[model samples]
Target: MSGELRIIPVTGLAEIEEGDDLAELVAAKLELENGDVLVLAQKIVSKSEGRVIALAGIEPSEEAREIAGDDEDPRRIEVILREAARVVRVRPPLVIAETTHGFICASAGVDASNAPEPEMLVLLPHDPDASARRIRDRIRELTGREVAVLVTDSFGRPWRQGTIDVALGASGLEVMRDLRGTRDPVGYELHSTMIAVADEIASAAELVMGKLDGVPAAVVRGLEVAGDGRALDLVIPEERDLFR
Candidate 1:
């Protein structure tokens, strides 16, 4: 596949809410083929599963209050704290945390942007991998086509200046492609050349699914990748983690 990959954005999806059938919505909009990879924004998944919270409904803990300081909203901080396993870094603008799912992201993958209400906050889907699997299986049952699903969220990198989409959970797709021991063009052996395929697909799909465009899902085609792996495979083990 040397030409170009095709990314088709699934547009006109109504505002997702709790109990919405996301698999049906996506299957109705796009004609999925075998090996097609669907990348869905995490916000829609969170909304569909009622993972949103009203800041007014929460009470701040002492740790949350201390972590937030004076300007920040203590209730929001409390929610972040509840979602996080440990605080990675604390700054006025943001709080980076290691989520219970082993994901390191700002505010424990919580989001206020595009929230249904002004006082509401959207949190990452509880058990995102399970969510992905369910969605994938539903789509297959509906369309009778084998497909992959990836739950994605925009995340700020440590050294990078801007945000990019990354895979939070995946099903029926290979998250990483390890190319170690493979020979290069000149027959030279390669080592430690693992590629984050799910993240790449997520970021590429984002090019078509704008942040505020109301497009929640995208289909990535024309790539030749096959495996039975989970998004957890993308995480760096604690023992090998260089960055704390």
Candidate 2:
């Protein structure tokens, strides 16, 4: 960890669309450097990957209709269900589900905000880790700089109010910092201490890329925590999950 860190927001990107070259677009706007951590919002990645869905095209099933009730649109619920592997909890309009990517999030990461059009929804990337890798690889090709890329999304924590940005996908970085055998300053040997470094970096990046700012990307500089790790490294195994 570096004593000085910098989070530079990458702005001026036009509204992303399906089939757009996201890596190229970002590279044109920012001058990236080697060892820089490029943090990207999930919405832009989803948009570029053509993951947006039109509500009018969705046909709600009986289960989706039942879950949506009369207050919410069944079409939206159907989209959420389609992306979710299993429903974790159902409370009226709020559906906590496990996404097919093994992420436990609200509505399986189906979001209506920042959509390209009205009555449309944006879905999480089918393979977020792959998405990150593609962007990272392209950036390297374009700028000849080896920068780490992280796809980030806002997630609500259990028993916590408000949401924080978390790493949905990662490339070229060690997502976790394990200190199991390291000794603390007090000379106490640590047995089980692991830090979610990727998530922390995502949250730090989000401090500059606000929700309404239209800034979808940021570069984290001066962090000496680059290596090989995926966002999956942060996921708790179902067998080890105490809440499940």
Candidate 3:
């Protein structure tokens, strides 16, 4: 019999801060097992690592001022500029940036919602894949149970309304399943079929961990994938960017 998939949210976590033991905090709340995948919201991970930045500390440059126009905050634009590898588009309230890590998002993933202070903004992890590995290793060391970890952030799709969680970092699981050269059930040779499993897991977990529900982490059980895969594998390189 196929195992039933379960997405269980772990609640009751205290507010995270820089230098906090995220693995310890998560383990204390959830009992993880082998084959389980822990999906963590990028916000909590950013908080735990002290990625929060004070808007007051930022000094907007002339370029930042020119991009922000009159109504938007220049300091926020400064932060986004610093985080972005390239500015894709600038339309005042919406600055689309390709992050240094190759993520294309609005405001370079510099978020202000749910910050510790009203004057603070949370930035993405300096190295999200490394962060996922650290969390996975720590959880394994503490519980003796092997599992995967995935960091997720919400992103808007082109031409699509609203947003959903997507994988920013991952460890100990296959992020993509490449099915090229395989034969289909109908006996036809399959080519160019790949699945982004990590992103799908993140999206599924988001169903329970809503935007304002205060849930930070969730356990995805019954997935059979086992490997040493990173979320970077999910990224489509610029050379292969059909949209570009």
Candidate 4:
């Protein structure tokens, strides 16, 4: 048998709702195993609990006018972008920022897709790691099975042409599998084999979820977890980041 782990998108996950048992809802649709990880879109999680912000009433502030392009500054768009962004990218028209929870993403990871109205956009949950932890705990509580959970959001890469999904928050899973001192199939000691497993899973899951497919959840099975508990420590911080 092949040893490679595979993640598959769980289709038809129906829209998530606030106060909904997220774990139970996910577990019901698919048969899960011990090492399987659940990849959840931050958008859906934000939506289900009525986190979608109606921008119609929001007014743009001085920061918004300065941040949002002069031509692109609609009052509502500015408000949502402002609240979501921790840092702003000034060179490009987009807001490349550290999120409230410290995820470095465009517009502080604020998204306009799947928004309720034409004039509205949605912001990510204030605390995604906490959000992931809650979901993981709830799933364990309801199904009595332990599994990893990751909240995902899309981000644009520097020096790259397109955007991709990335893990914003995760729990009950180790985000990275460090193989720094390990060896490859050959006897060569690996110095940089530490893999970002959670981000990889998020990207794979999005391949099936699609930007417009409305699919929000995906299952990754057969992979060995690095261990259990939250993986917020695995990510890099802005100050230490050399790429900025």
Which is better, 3 or 4, measured by lDDT?
3
**Model 4, residue pairs in steric clash:** 18-48, 95-107
Between candidates 3 and 4, the one scoring higher on TM-score is: 3
Q: What is the TM-score of each candidate against the true structure?
A: 0.97, 0.98, 0.97, 0.87
lDDT of 4 by residue, 54-169 (tens): 66677777766765666665564465456654555654356677655666776666667777567656778777778888888887787777788899887788888888888888
Which sequence of candidate numbers ranks them by TM-score, best first? 2, 3, 1, 4
| Number of colliding residue pairs in model 4 | 2
Top-down lDDT ranking: 2, 3, 1, 4
The predicted structure with the larger TM-score, 2 or 4, is 2
Deviation from native of the Cα of residue 46 in model 1, angstroms: 0.9
Candidate 4 achieves a global lDDT of: 0.74
lDDT of 2 at 149: 96
The numbered model that scores best in TM-score is 2
User: What is the C-alpha local distance difference test score of each model?
Assistant: 0.90, 0.94, 0.91, 0.74
Runs with alpha carbons beyond 4 Å of true place in candidate 3: none
lDDT of 3 by residue, 82-153 (tens): 999999887887998999998998899999998988989999999899999999999999999899999999
Which window of ten consecutive residues has the lowest lDDT sum in model 2?
1-10
Residues 1-244 of candidate 1 have per-residue lDDT tens digits of: 3757899999989999999999999988879999889999999999999999999879899988887788888889999989999999988648999999999999999888989999899999988889999999999889899898999999899888999999998999778888899999999988789999899999999999989889989999988666677887788999999997
Instruction: For candidate 1, list the clashing residue pairs, or say none.
Output: none
Error of 4 at 224 (Å): 0.9
